[model samples]
Target: MNLLEYLNQNYLMLVPALWVLGFALKQTPAIPNWMIIWVLLFVSITVGSLTFGFSYEGLINGITAAGVAVLGHQMVKQALLGSGSRKK
Candidate 1:
């Protein structure tokens, strides 16, 4: 019932849930893109610590999870929109 044990058991679910939250927030124009990233990062860390019990490991995991979500979002955006290509 410890935090580490809970994390080990539910990491897969927790990580994706954070990603989905970030992606959804990205659709809102009320906030700037940079703010969105930072907000998601903060939320990820806060959620991880609060839900799993606060610890250094939880903070690191939260940062890693947020980074993964951002990377995934950018990858998908570039892939589907062909945004990586440039025309001159």
Candidate 2:
């Protein structure tokens, strides 16, 4: 599938995955759900008009990358926060 079609078929799973990443950052994060929805709408209208076969590898890659980025951000946030604390 092309980039647009790939995005459309998988965007549902992608947006929420992005949101979870934003939530984990617990700071300022870009790419909110509203933007994601807009992207999906655009893709659906344009590229998503055509349907294609499913791709397990694409799905797995998208989720795994998003998940890893989220975990890494969370780890950094925790470490930074922990370092700034005072102990009794």
Candidate 3:
């Protein structure tokens, strides 16, 4: 099954939007490092809710979008950086 099947088509776009927003936040000195995830979560839910109305699907999609954004970023980062520990 397509992994994105779990999310609404509309929500899929949020994944990359979140990445851009996260990157922008990271560049801003006023935002704290620890708060980025929370900010993303809040934006995700708010945007989802606004797009689809306040409902179960909206909440789920918001949470899922944030997850996909974060997961995708980690996958790319890990691939480029490799494992933290080197083989003996």
Candidate 4:
């Protein structure tokens, strides 16, 4: 089977897994927050392209996946911790 077919079939699993990874990265103190976001974006694009035979569609999907992850993380944090609380 081709990469697109595989991606279509497995995106449900893949996207969430990538999102969780981004969330975990956010918790690590070794890397800055901005760097974590960029890293996740880069990871999404690279992984998607490599897994799906490299295409514009793959790139777009990767970016979307990363955005979903980041947004989800922020939403969860805000909901659970309240917006007024700063981590620093």
Candidate 5:
């Protein structure tokens, strides 16, 4: 298989996995929403730039991915922790 095909295959798997991972990260102690968003955003952008060769959309895609990840993490966290309030 060619490099592009190999990358596309992995990207398909990774996108969903990243969502799961973002939620997992939320379970950790003191995992700020901002940090999670930034990290995921940076990773997605880096991947897009390297994989699809998006020159300008690199920043935009990165921001969008990060927002999506953060929102997903927040939803998962709320589901698990009950409206984001810490259980006493």
Candidate 6:
């Protein structure tokens, strides 16, 4: 099942935006590794609310966007890194 189906079409753009923001956060010295997700979520929520007004659907879409961005990053990362087993 595509998790993205639950998100609004308008919110789809936010996924990539969040990903880029997360990447920037990772590169920053002050952000720290653990806080990156929270930062992304906060930005996503704010963006959603601003776009659609404050409401349950807006909040849910924000959450879904953040989730998709993080999940996509991790999936790609795992594919490239493998399961921690390297053959020399």
TM-scores vs. true structure, each candidate: 0.73, 0.37, 0.87, 0.72, 0.53, 0.92
Measured by lDDT, the strongest candidate is 6
The alpha-carbon deviation from the true structure for residue 4 of candidate 3, after best TM-score superposition, in angstroms, is 2.0
> Stretches of candidate 6 above 4 Å error?
84-88
Error of 1 at 58 (Å): 0.3
| Model 6 per-residue lDDT tens digits across residues 51-87 | 8899999999999999999999999998999978677
Q: Judging by TM-score against the true structure, name the best candidate.
A: 6
* Model 3: colliding residue pairs: none
- lDDT of candidate 3 over 1-88, digit per residue (tens): 5557798998988999999999999999999988998999999999999988999989999999998898888788789888774577
Per-residue error for 85 in candidate 4, Å, reads 2.6
Candidate scoring better on lDDT of 2 and 5: 5
For 12-78, candidate 4 gives per-residue lDDT tens digits of 4556787777768878888887798798889888887888768877877777777766777777878
Model 4: CA > 4 A from native: 1-10, 83-88
Give the per-residue lDDT digits (tens) of candidate 1, residues 1-88.
Answer: 2333334443445567877777687788887877887988898888778888788878877777677667777778788989458676
lDDT of 5 by residue, 36-68 (tens): 666676777787678667766555555555555
The global Cα lDDT (0 to 1) of model 5 is 0.61
| Model 6 clashing-pair count | 0
Query: How big is the RMSD of model 6?
Result: 2.3
lDDT against true structure, model 3: 0.91
Which residue pairs collide, candidate 2? Answer: none
